[model samples]
Target: MSQLNRVAWIVTVGSCLVAALILVLSGYTGYAGVTLAVAIAAAINLF
Candidate 1:
């Protein structure tokens, strides 16, 4: 299940980035920033 775990992490990072983008478009900079941080953390897990 290693492959599945990697895929899950990738999806998590991708979705977080997308959510951050949406938040930014809707004027939720604070929340967007938090989302970005989470995305960064997820990306780190990719390594």
Candidate 2:
């Protein structure tokens, strides 16, 4: 695999995890936690 493919895989897996975390948090805390996790993950991947 190439560097871009590797990064894409990371992004895809990260997105799935973020979504699941958000969904789980949605049932308890709310959208805020999910949104925060997604934002944090996105920020991490950006750099």
- What is the C-alpha lDDT profile of model 1 across 2-28, one tens digit per residue? 999999999999999999999999999
lDDT of 2 by residue, 1-47 (tens): 57886688577657756776767766855665665566566556545
lDDT of each: 0.96, 0.65
Candidate 1: give its CA RMSD in angstroms. Answer: 1.2
Against the true structure, candidate 2 reaches a TM-score of 0.54
Model 2, backbone clash pairs (residues 3+ apart or across chains), number: 0
